[model samples]
Target chain A: MNRIILGVDPGSRATGYGLIAATGESLLHLESGFIALPAQLSHSQRLARIYQRLESLISRYNPEALAVEAVFLAHNVQSALKLGQVRGVVLLAAGQADIPVFEYSPLTLKKAIVGYGQATKTQVLLMVENLLGLTLNNHNTADALALSLCHHFHSRWPQRSVSPAAI
Target chain B: MNRIILGVDPGSRATGYGLIAATGESLLHLESGFIALPAQLSHSQRLARIYQRLESLISRYNPEALAVEAVFLAHNVQSALKLGQVRGVVLLAAGQADIPVFEYSPLTLKKAIVGYGQATKTQVLLMVENLLGLTLNNHNTADALALSLCHHFHSRWPQRSVSPAAI
Candidate 1:
């Protein structure tokens, strides 16, 4: 059976997204890119753009699920608030499309991609490239692809209890 | 000319909304209430509920503007993040409807409704009831109506430059 997954790395300024198809035991990249919100747009406008873009992506690809990074609490109050706003829209888009959403911590993403939870950004990027058999330049896109791959790997191990959260 | 305004007091657990109609020197309360989200619902489900409810409100009232509290930095990082997620959906609903949004600080809300920045919650609620010619029990609804009144008062003074932010 073949399943398509959409992964998103959402931000206030830029939201990166990647799509992949899983067929039996092979993973193939379908698309990867980032939506760049100009500095001139207000915060509300930026959110609107993120929602519209993701809605269009879902419409185009009709993915089976959405994968994203879980909430990271290391940021200060202001930054965390801003980041949460971005994540809110990302989740809203998924909810509107009735697609299941899965969240993976940064450490989990690193381990899935680079075989270690504390792997450096460069190492994760290199390993993702090796796994996907492609050269990637955008860190945001790379992270999004890494998120998709994490879900793919997790879905294969039903005994590990890697089901989507009850959202 | 009569103009409608929607005020929102967004939170993760409950989001309060109120509607007011401005006719010359009079402010009339149209509706006010809070949406209570059960803890059993996940965070994403909560956001989706907020978005859907607000969208229905916008569709029902067709308000000319949305008034909400500005970002309050007093809370800890986690709380701020959760609150921001709620605010994000509020803004998104307004944005999708092409309604302008205005933000007022708590100090400003108190001053507008109670004639002082340091007024107590009871004082603000009483003043809002008096101003709208109604009795209110829900603090969330009271705060939301106060926000609408704040915009009403600010809009009357063109010299104060109380225009909507470029959102």
Candidate 2:
């Protein structure tokens, strides 16, 4: 059995999740995708769909641990609230599986993958592909993989990591 | 045989729920609770357990509608994120039952029951008890009732209300 890890970039509009497994030397990507819930649905309806999708992903991947992106709220209050709700679903999925969850910030993930804390999304995605030896065009999928890679590297070198999601 | 309304005041640490029904010109309080989960659990774990409990509550209460507090943020980003997750569970619970969810805010509820939008937490609690004619202290329970009342009133007179959780 492989030691699998699930990384989630949680958001209300589109939540991206990636599953990866690390061998003694390198990491292998198993699956990655984003769940897009309609914005028009009552917020509750949207959340239900998200929870359902997240649960299915967990069962399908059966990861040993989950690494989700910490909720990032820049300034917009409404956006931040929605993000919190999305993170809730991410955590709920891990909890249901009785798996320990580790949280990573977007910046931390970028720094780990691209060697800079200020790397852009596109830059991080390109570096992730280079590191994984795969050319991925899908931004969400690439971002998810980057998050997974970051978690793997962070787990290996705790001293190089930042304060991940509290929990 | 009553128009029971279930109100939920979701939080990262405790999810407060209340049930009530309108009787002619009065409102009668029913069962309520604080779904307390340890903060040690990862966000996902907390949310999963919350979902299970909320699902049971919805099944038992069979509320006609659900009123949930919207996302409230004030400088504290992590708190907002946690609150968002709980609020999402509230949304998911209401949605799975195909129950229409009504949104409310602290200010609107406080003003409706206490006649002051800026009422302190203590004032709001006192007003909720007086408005609902409760003889005992159920502080969290009262918050739920207030959310329900605010929603009920808004549904009746949409023009006269401002819902905080409108999203």
Q: Give the DockQ-based CAPRI class for model 2.
A: medium
What fnat does each of the candidate structures reach?
0.62, 0.73
DockQ for every prediction shown: 0.59, 0.62
Task: Give the TM-score between model 1's chain B and the true chain B.
Answer: 0.95
Q: lDDT per prediction?
A: 0.86, 0.75
Best by DockQ: 2
Distance (Å) between predicted and true CA of B145, model 1? 1.2
DockQ of 1: 0.59
Candidate 2 local lDDT, B16-115, one digit each (tens): 7878887656778877777788867656667887889878888987888988765465467656666777877778778789888877666777777778
Instruction: Using lDDT, give the best candidate's number.
Output: 1
Measured by TM-score, the strongest candidate is: 1
Off by over 4 Å in 2: A71-73, A156-164, B71-73, B131-133, B136-138, B156-165
